[model samples]
Target: MSLAERPDLMTTDPVTWDGGMGSVGDYIALLKPRVMSLVIFTAFVGMMLAPGSIHPVLAAVALLCIAIGAGASGALNMWYDADIDRVMSRTAKRPIPAGKITPSEALAFGMTLSVGSVVLLGLLVNWFAGAFLAFTIFFYAVVYTMWLKRSTPQNIVIGGAAGAFPPMIGWAAVTGGVSLESFILFLIIFMWTPPHFWALALFKSGDYRAAGIPMLPVVAGEDATRTQILLYSLVLVPIAVSPWFLGFAGVTYGIASAVLGAGFLGLALQVYRLRTGEAARKAAVRLFSYSILYLFLLFALLLGESLVTRMI
Candidate 1:
């Protein structure tokens, strides 16, 4: 049966079919928890690196707000992008596209979570954080999902700012304002996004092409995308070291940043050098996988250095 004919399939409660069964977990999968985990981790790192300390309970509350906001963004994105998503292989099985969740329900869920997270953060934590969280929702759901994704080749470039906001929000939760330090954190993620996503685009061009999305690989072609990746990776190395130059981090972070930056550039260069379809795809996948590790390790090192300096 077509998706619209079986509205009952979208409900969260258990459904017994000719095949087997489904439950609440399907709806949770719709929220994109794996993506939320990364949001929480980066925000946590930002909070930790911020100048002041938040109480443990308050910190937990802040993190919860961030997670809820991230999930809200994801839900709304799914709601709006369902049509295109159904056409794309990578996204065809998502809850909305799979007919496991209705667009209206996802919209309601996202709206409720967005409002709840912002209000709770304002009441329990701080308004600056609340405001940032609210903006993040709007930027992702409206700016990126509704407008940018369908319109521009630079969609990921501009849309990346939405993902880059969590660290600043986390910093604001503790400090009640933005600062150069938080901005450096922001810049790091911003610069890192193009290379990371373009790597994925290189290997997944078919999915993007099917969705009619103008990703770098679709518009600029593989060779140009590879060149852009190399250029962006080169620029990122210096930006990654800016935390040390700006005095937000110590020499340890500077050293780690240099090493990580070199590793990232090396991968990008490999991707550029290996121009054959199979080799490029392998390099792209390797770079995509390593990029996640690279960001997490960069932040972890920063947090560790902060802790050690405090102890000393």
Candidate 2:
């Protein structure tokens, strides 16, 4: 249904959060700490790959700022989507919907982190990196969570850019600007996102429908989503191996990328061919699970290559 036909689908009634003090754990939940780990790892890889060395303390601070910025975006997303979250079984336990934290409090907390992260990064690292972090938070919180998610089925396709910026941001922290290598890192994540996310969307179509989200599977149906996933996976396989061609990675990374990319493509193909049932869910889940490992192993190979080179 078009939003115009069902305005209530996207609109939420006002919710008031009592200023009741929650535990530290509750506050951490508001930050979506698990999600922060991915940002930290990718950003760390980017920093390690940059051409020059930053002081250890400064590097630590930069990573901290990045984590906090990512957390702030998560908080803002929870705040804005609390209503939809309450209806969806998957997200119903999140801090906001569970009443562990108030939307107003989350807003204040996110804003504080967002500003603090950018300013501290600028003061301690460089203005360019700080600006980049600020933009990343804004793009994720405002652009993706607020604008794109409910508005279009292509939400993950475009919104994935917000998540892709971390490596570039990390590179900027060291080199003071984006380099082609860092962008390749960014592109890998950007392209991997659709296939990764769509796989989940396939299995979680019910949760999305309940929340009125326009996830690819929800909006376009299963077969279309499977085709799109296959198409993205095919394109992504080459991009995953491109770092080796671009000369930033070594034979170890090249070999790993080739193997992992093939696994990724094969899983995506499995998803495309399966019919709806336990078999279909198994394929989609397998693809989704392997996609995470694919990204981590690919980046880890680059990191390992760098370490061995330094020793040599």
Candidate 3:
């Protein structure tokens, strides 16, 4: 892109480059593999917790499909967001924005994977899971990326549902439908997303402003964003511990959830109470960093609980 097209990425006049010499790794980056890790983990937890038996081979197939479908969603998101991504420092080096992959190539790659994953999943596993996976890709690519992202300050708030669906899909893969158990898993992620992302948005308000994406921090101001974060964190604490209370998990999980939920609330409070200077930034960063670990550990406890129960 020329200087006019993307001064954020290009220091000089626009010059055409052949979208870089993409390697296997570059293509993988287009799939947002880092983001997929959480999705894959939560899906596995769902599959493990679900009440049913899937053949080992078929179980692997289900996971592969979930991973591929999630990757396709990421690829499509990158394709659609390339313009804004080029301007955001955090995303400026993504495959599309970095010119390692062309938009058309990304779109084609995403579409092909989307169709293949859904079709194979339906045939190999169950139609319910397959349909859910297809809807996830569509919701992320079209509903969230294309529509909600640029149009609303609550984009992440709603777009988070797309991320929340994977675990439910995994549960469906084994059980052939969703259950209350699967839905609580979904809710944990759903409630967690706003506070998690708003923390990053708090630290990166300039990026959203430059990209013209109306994130809560950009549209609602820092005070409002911080308040929302604390409120969400408060709500998330009880939900995080509910699996244990509801009898799907053990006392070990109850303790873990209680501790992690407390930490999450504490961090949110730090972000809310402390404003201005490096202290505020640090609070946001701490919350963002810990939020990821909090989710992983919460799910890990459930997976461990399930395994121990089966063994005993």
Candidate 4:
């Protein structure tokens, strides 16, 4: 049947299809749990690195709110992006695009969670964090997904600030305000975003082209994209080490940042040098994979050093 005639196929009853229980996994999938994990981790690291201590229960509530906020953003993003997602091969299997969840339902779910998270955080935690959470949702749903993604080649560059807000939110949860230290964490993620995303964009150029999304590789040539990726990586190296120079972090994080920064630059160079074929694809994938590892390791080291200092 044609797509137009398959209304039943397009509409999803998530409740009926999964026999009511819905499995723990499908619900988790709705939250974009993998991304949520990163949100939780980075936010936790930010909290740990910030001055002062929070009660464990308060900490738990703050993290829960952050996770819900992240999920809410993802659901809204999925809801809005579902159209292009249906067309893109990589995103076609997502819950909304696959008809496992309807767009309206996803939108409602996201809105509910968004409001609930902000309210609970404001009441149980602090308004500073709650405000940040609310802004994050607005930024991701309205600013990034709705406006920026379709409008410019610098979409990721600008939209990245939304993702970078998690650490600041977490820091606010602890200190009730933003600081240069928190912004340092934010800066690291911000600087890392373009290279990280462009690496994926390099290989997914076809999917983006088919979806009519003007990613770097689609608007600019692959060669230009590669050069931009290398340049961003070069800029990120020093910024990643800035926390150490500023005394928010120690020599341990500084050394680790320098090493990882060099490794990231090496990968970007590889991506630049590789020929435009399967080899280039492999290099892009490798950079994408390592980029995640690099960010996680950098934050993990920061958390570890903070813990060691606390113990000492």
Candidate 5:
């Protein structure tokens, strides 16, 4: 049985500083910068696509607050999950588990940024955006990390709403309200997250199982997880393509979405079919990697069209 399955053997020692304070890099690593970058990009796309305009300075500030809020959520997650982090090979070297930063310090850092970001965004921009940003942080840090992550196989499904809110917050930053167009953007990410994360969980099932993460693959088995990945992918593609048909996007976006979406579906299908051995692992890895590119390109196309339309 996995260490996680043998809970009696699991260590609960208090995590403390090793010898000295962490370096700047170690501190930043606590923020999960890779994830933060994605949040910033997605939020920026939402801000850009909003119908109305925001002052350039306010727009930059909104993005900054959103980024900081996202980083804060990451830090909090690392803090709370440090116990599991130490057990999972993939996460073993995270700042907290590596003893580069104390859990209390990480918690303080995260909370400070979380409150500060929401307050600054509200005061400097619109409260609607600020409120949504606050909720996003709370959802990721509290709802997802603290609650759902360890407790349910449906964790990623329910927790994805947190990530989906960034675009809506960006839209509210400009228009001070959400419309169906903005919600569609939100829906695209929400639907895409399950398959994307599940693909990662497939190859990393061992890591998740060892850490007791209860990822779908760990709880439901690989075949079940693969089936769910394909189902989510099928639903995700059309929702991803909808912004184009809904008239918010143009033909260029429509064509790009359709083509990119075909590639996404093709990979998802491959993951579904390749059911065992190294081929299965490779397929899951490909889908995981492609999902990142697919989402980026889909949003990039929309951003490009928005900019070109503005220019013309």
Candidate 6:
């Protein structure tokens, strides 16, 4: 429903829509900066791994546009999810939910950034990359947040595409197209997302349940979520290791991927086995934490190897 149509959301009570100035930090908070950081890192790795080099200035611009697009997606998500964000403990402090920023303000901020980023990227970089970035924003803000997240347990499973597109977009920014190597990068993150999020869902099932989010654990039960985590981890490891086998990465990355993949599976196994009490929660938290590091290290390794190869 439109903000114009929802009286409760349009109140000038400061907590809802005061039409007052929010601090700069409140505006930044609407962007979900942590998630934007991951999007930036992965997209940079994709750029570095692409076959051709871009002018460093253009590359930086591309990354900036990507970061803005990601931030826009986050703001829109926060705006739309505000109602439920108020209920969930984890998100209750978000700018909109915490009364730091109004929903109308956030919507305007997101829409402006979303349009500006795509247009600038298209004009300054490449249209292909611009188009992909636009789709990523739409997928996250509309497809995942507006639809899947509220309606199905497979939310993360399908919505993961939004997060997984950055590398491909980055690759397109440099090469003006996609390739097998880029898709491998995409696939690695895509497969990793389910296990990563389901682990968080395992521990935060209560929060999801309270918020009516329909996360896998909240909808399917913990045992089923654990099983899915393990199953996805099994697929993720091989895909994470694939760039090495596919000739894009060197032996160092291969060894590191194998080691990292082992650690991932080990944590996932613990999450799967410890299904009750504090032990289970701890296991889930561990898996969730490690999953972040796992993806970062994988991309960091790929970026490092590509840079070294270029120098040699």
lDDT of each: 0.89, 0.92, 0.93, 0.91, 0.92, 0.94
TM-score of each: 0.91, 0.94, 0.93, 0.92, 0.93, 0.94
Off by over 4 Å in 6: 1-17
Query: What is the TM-score of candidate 5?
Result: 0.93
Q: Which candidate is the best by TM-score?
A: 6
Please provide, for model 3 over 1-312, each residue's C-alpha lDDT reduced to its tens digit, 9 standing for 90 to 100.
566797567566676778546789988998889888888888999999999788989989999999999999999999999999999999999988887788998998999999999999999999999999999999999999999999999999999999999889989999999889999999999999999999999999999999999999888899999999999999999999999889999999999899999999999999999999999999999999999999999999999999999899
Against the hidden true structure, what lDDT does model 4 obtain? 0.91
| Superposed Cα deviation of residue 244, candidate 5 (Å) | 0.9
Best-to-worst lDDT order: 6, 3, 2, 5, 4, 1
lDDT per residue (tens digit) for residues 57-162 in model 5? 9999999999999999999999999999999988999988888888988999999999999999999998989899989998999899999999999999999999
Tell me the number of clashing residue pairs for each predicted model: 0, 0, 1, 0, 0, 0
14-97 in candidate 4: lDDT tens per residue? 545432333445456778898899999999998999899999999999999999999999989998999999989988988876
The residue pairs found clashing in candidate 1 are none
Q: In candidate 2, residue 69 scores what lDDT?
A: 95
Residue pairs with backbone atoms closer than 3 Å in model 6 (clashes): none
The Cα error of candidate 3 at residue 12, in Å, is 33
Off by over 4 Å in 5: 1-20
| Candidate 2 C-alpha error for residue 228, in Å | 0.4
Better of 5 and 6 by TM-score: 6
Better of 1 and 2 by TM-score: 2
